[model samples]
Target: MISTAWGISFRAFDIGQLRIFFAFGVLQILNLIFISVFTLYQMLSVHTSLTLLALTPIFFMLLTTKIIMPRMAAFTRQNQEAVGLLTNRVTEAFTNIHVIQTNASERSFQRLIAQENDKVYATDMKVLMLRTLFFPLMSALTGLSQLVVLFYGGSLVVQNKISVGDILAFNIYLSYLAFPLTSIGIILSVYQRSKTALERLDPFFNETPESGSDAKILPFPNPNEVDIQDLHFTYPGSIHPVFMGLNLRIRKGEMLGVCGSVGSGKSTLFQILTRIYEPPVGTTYFEGKDVTTLDPITLRREIAYALQKVHLFSASIADNLSFGLIDRPSEEELARASRSAQILKEIESFPDKWDTQIGEKGLRLSGGQKQRLALARLFLRKPKILLLDDVLSAVDNITEARLIQEFRGIGCTMIINSHRGSVLE
Candidate 1:
């Protein structure tokens, strides 16, 4: 499976195209020497002085490598960054279009997009302009080299050392050399742009995996029980600690209700328990075994966590309900789970029923419908520990009470985090 950073890099750039361009540039460079030697040999055969004309192409390559290529690469990098930023802004605008409309901030968002678009345009123009000037500069140097070859070779003919026909032959070979030289310069320009894309992707390839490949898969005797001793933690980039000397325990088949205010680490607690963020070793344990030593994939198998903010893809009701399931649930199984979550009646009310399409993030559904839909998805999977993080927040008292009844009936060790104190009672 790919990580978050890798996913973002893929969206930001076309990696496959970059590799193709880089390979073409390398192959051209490899063939350049043989082409240069074969063409220049004819000139060297006529007179040794005529071979000095090679300096023109050589000087042009040197200028391209030292000055022109670096500038091209720098601007190419800037252009990529600008384009990526603009893409992010566009995605955000579309995702929150409703919010923008309600706030009457359409012009504000438009201005933001216009500013990013200008940057992308400015950086792209710089790269294109540099490439436009590159070919003409090569031609100018080639023309200058021709003038030198004609004057010196003509001198040889006047002294009767070489025939006039030989001077004509030397100039013809000189013209042949220009094509390969100009081709190599073009290759270098394309190569610089590809090289910049590779640099942007380097960090993703170099990052370390959060879980080790060789981590042990220890079986938990009491997988549903949690025992923490003096747990202390602070989020990254935060000075204040969320938990200090926090000790807690939950027995098997027990339902613990956690009530807290906003930013009080209720969600963070669920994250830590599920190994989303690894807890300190010797502090958190399952069946007396240090959780840090367990494989994250193996450990997460016994836990099913439904987040507060439900995420529904643009898919059918059936697909969203059976998400994360190892095997597709049968029609009967889907109905049972939906019934338990109290969403079956609404789903059945639709003309298409199970096949009905739910728009992105379930935009077609109300807040309570979305929450129950998430619960249905959760009910499809049977884990040893069930973590419901403020799942009943959107529903009314009657709906919440029914869901709580459903939770109690499931008979699993459950930890429910919510702001309502009555949920615990």
Candidate 2:
């Protein structure tokens, strides 16, 4: 993949997207020689010029740069933060475009986006000015060192303390020394940029790690039962709890309808059960075992979740429907699930049908289409338990009724969160 014409996409790309580099770690070992040789050579051959004149200006440059570099780093940090704000605004604007249109709040969004853009422009200017200033300052420091050597070394040669040829050699050596000594500043700058990249990547390190030997092997989780006992949970850094002393039990082949107002923790309950958010120990259990103790991979594979806001990647219809299954779903199976979700007729109407490429997050599909497609994908999995969060909201009454009838035909345990009383019926 690395040698291919397409490397990584720059859009939303970050250090966290270093899968290719980490995979080819051995291939990068050769490049290290260049950095090591240049850096080691400069360190060893630093004092080639013995005179006080040659050494004085170099030391002065070092002292001042140490002070200036910290300021440059601060500017870089602010610039990154400004860029982050711009990114967030762009994401938010696109995601809630429907809401923006419904409320006719384009002007309000325009003003807010303009404000964020101004912040980005101001921070960028600061970084550019500091960077431009750095090069000129470096040039002046190097030039002054050469001037000092001529004035001082020439006088020494004329005084018979040193020969003219000796003074000439000293001048030539100073020129050679200057290149590597000046390079030190460039190296420090590269270091600063790399540090900033690492900072951008820090959040990935905070994610919950995958299970290893320390995790309990749950080879056989009872497909029929899920239980929550006295579950009290809050998000990280949040003082208030979302679920407090919550208890629920779901037995084999039972269909549970969950209905609540907004902010009532319906979706959160599913997230905790699926181990997307770790719950307190002894709080939630699957197959009669604590959910926390179960291997995360096993937990996820056995349970299927479909959220209200469906997400479909930019890919062919068949690919999206078969995304997680160990075996590619056969055409017959695809047709069955799509039919169950009431999307098969629409999908077959496409010129390429299953082969047709859907735009990003199924942009080409209508809201009801996306929801049906997501449901069909989960249906193909035939997971032991289904966690559907308002999946039927977008579809019309007749279509939703048809879907619910087919879904119950599968005979799997299901927990559905829906606001529609018709759905509950």
Candidate 3:
């Protein structure tokens, strides 16, 4: 039966599915036949009524599959979805754990977790109930079937139409039918689960990122400059506009400062400039070419960013610093870049120096150290434009002054987002 189902499901492709399904099905069938044959031989030459009476449990097992399996599959799918939701909630909480704990939100967190747990538990209980109802009902039905077989077969024996041994052989075939029927539900449930899992992941497999027509090889231009005209943007699902009719021009070798209070759309502006979020339809130009016409990867490669929240890989200090460079830098080059960022002394203090692992997100480093390390990485890349989003906030006044003095001679177009007016002065 499983083979037949597989054949129907994959008929358009080939018989490979059928062959695999049939191979397993045949093995199960052989096992059933062996058990039935052994039982029949033991009961042969015995009274026909006695043999029929012993076959009740087998009939009940067959009846259970017909009634039980569909409910179990539905419950399993529900339970999986509940667990997925719970995991998402836990991840979100951990990402904001600092805020939650600071705000004394332990009760709120507990409530949210409890709600998800309750949903999972309810679905789990439903599955248990289904099993409880199925097993006993199957046993009762099998008992009934055996009683009917005994009464009918006994009459046939008395009339001499069939021998007692023949009746026992026939009962053996009935037993074979019972085992397969009982197991059928479990097989179908597995099929349903596998199908659901595939469907859940189908969108990721089917969808590809949109590509522009002008993505072919183009000549690399020197002295990269950017111009934005009437750029407007609103975040997804946001009611208020982030930027409306914003215009700016950034020329080569010029450093620009974008200062604004919290929620003043500073980061949003940077996202627009980088094309991480597309500006409203108009024109954003890069090196005299329209940004919409340029490949996103090419545009980003020319621009280096050091965000307020720096992310580092779990690798050696050298690997993190040299991440954006096309060719691997020599140890001396890495040391020079680190010194230029004023982080070489600190890195050298570590047990392994440049070869030391930073751990996940550079959690092992202090905020100032992480920012400096990120700056080292940006310097290594040597992009045409550098955008530093509040990168100097964590450093002391003297360190901040030293960084600003060094940045002045870096010879790259820079955009600094900072709250410190003294730095701008």
Candidate 4:
């Protein structure tokens, strides 16, 4: 019964702003009928009193349906928001559980959960208080209306204007009407709360994502080069500039090394290259074609990036390496790429070899092993332009030297971003 009531209440409220207009029309119609019927009943003969009594309960039920549901909806929506907030808190804490434990913040987490719980509890109590007050007040109002009907009708019966049987029937109808009239307040409350919930969810329904522009068309030119001219950028909500008039270029088959201090716009430059962040008042051209005009997906596919923080999915080594390759690569091709990355030997040592599962973010592997695995994946991509962002940082000097030598041999247009220049040399 509660579910059915909730569904009806929600439907009435969520049908849009038309709810108010429709509700107003309904209330006006009910008011007119209610006034007209009572006035006519007072003037009608005693024989007609029974007919009026029969409709009284039906009129009260209509009042309950139209009036009470909307108010109940408002309270329900408030409770839902409180629950949503509590759930968000729990999810955020769980996601950052490691950091919380590391900092010994169990008490702080508990306090936050407690605070959210208390807020929900208080809101629930307020809703309960409103419900308690609404029911009794409605019941009293309904009883008073019945009392008026009985007194007036009884007097008419005593004066030989109405029959006793007619008066009794009228009283019975009035008694039946009382329950429905009292329920009207509850119905209105339900409608109101549901309306509030739909309003709260409106933003998500109307949301437009950041990328809504049409893609530009530009063909690639000869000499397959990437150029950044007078580029400038700053992150959203940040006051300081991440990049200021930065200019760089990478020609086909040219290996360019990028060296800078920590937080010196290296990663920001890569982000712009990937078109994750739009460059301010400047252009990045790839193979003589404006990168902004080119599709971001195509640009990213052509330009491979291997970051210091390597991320590997929980899948077999072979699956991770061949991620972007269309039509699964031959076993020989996969082996060749793995060998170049110097991780094939390590994989072979594992019990499952290429089929071994690398746990989330490659947690099962050592830092150097993870870096090698990421490089292996990058090698499999065979991109035209490779962006190696501190890929050798985790490996030892010997391994870094060999990897750099191996990378130089690949002959792709490479931009190596790292503080250590010796690896590049």
Quick one: best lDDT, which candidate? 1
Angstrom error at residue 33, model 1: 4.0
In candidate 3 the C-alpha lDDT for residue 401 amounts to 84
Query: What lDDT score goes with residue 191 in model 1?
Result: 76
Q: Provide the overall lDDT of each model, using Cα atoms, as 2-decimal numbers.
A: 0.82, 0.77, 0.71, 0.71
lDDT of 2 by residue, 8-30 (tens): 21224344324433433323333
Candidate 4 lDDT tens digits, 1-425: 12333333334344443365356535644764585466446535444554455345446655654564555565566676676667667766865787999999999999999998898898778778778877777776667656666776677778987777877765665665554466566555655554566675465467644344465555644425888888777888889987777777777899888888998888878788777777653377777666667666666777788876788888988888888777687778878888888878898899988889998768689988989988987778887888898888888888888788878888888888887878667
Model 1: ten consecutive residues of lowest lDDT = 1-10
How far in Å is the alpha carbon of 22 misplaced in model 3? 15
lDDT of 1 by residue, 138-237 (tens): 7767777778777877787889989989878877877777776777668877777677777777776787785644556666555778898999989877
Please identify model 3 stretches exceeding 4 Å from their true place. Answer: 1-74, 92-115, 135-166, 199-203, 210-223, 324-326
Question: What is the TM-score of each predicted model, taking all chains together?
Answer: 0.91, 0.85, 0.74, 0.68
Tens digits of lDDT, candidate 3, 1-425: 12332223233222332344455645665665676676566664554555556665555565566566667778866865676666656766776787999999989998998898899799878866876676556545655655655677778789986677766665665565566545444344444455545554455456656354444535545536778888777888888988788888988888888888899988877777777887654567767776665567776788888888888899999989888778999988888878878889998899999899988878789988988899888778778888888888878898888788777777888788888897777
Q: lDDT score, residue 90, model 2?
A: 68
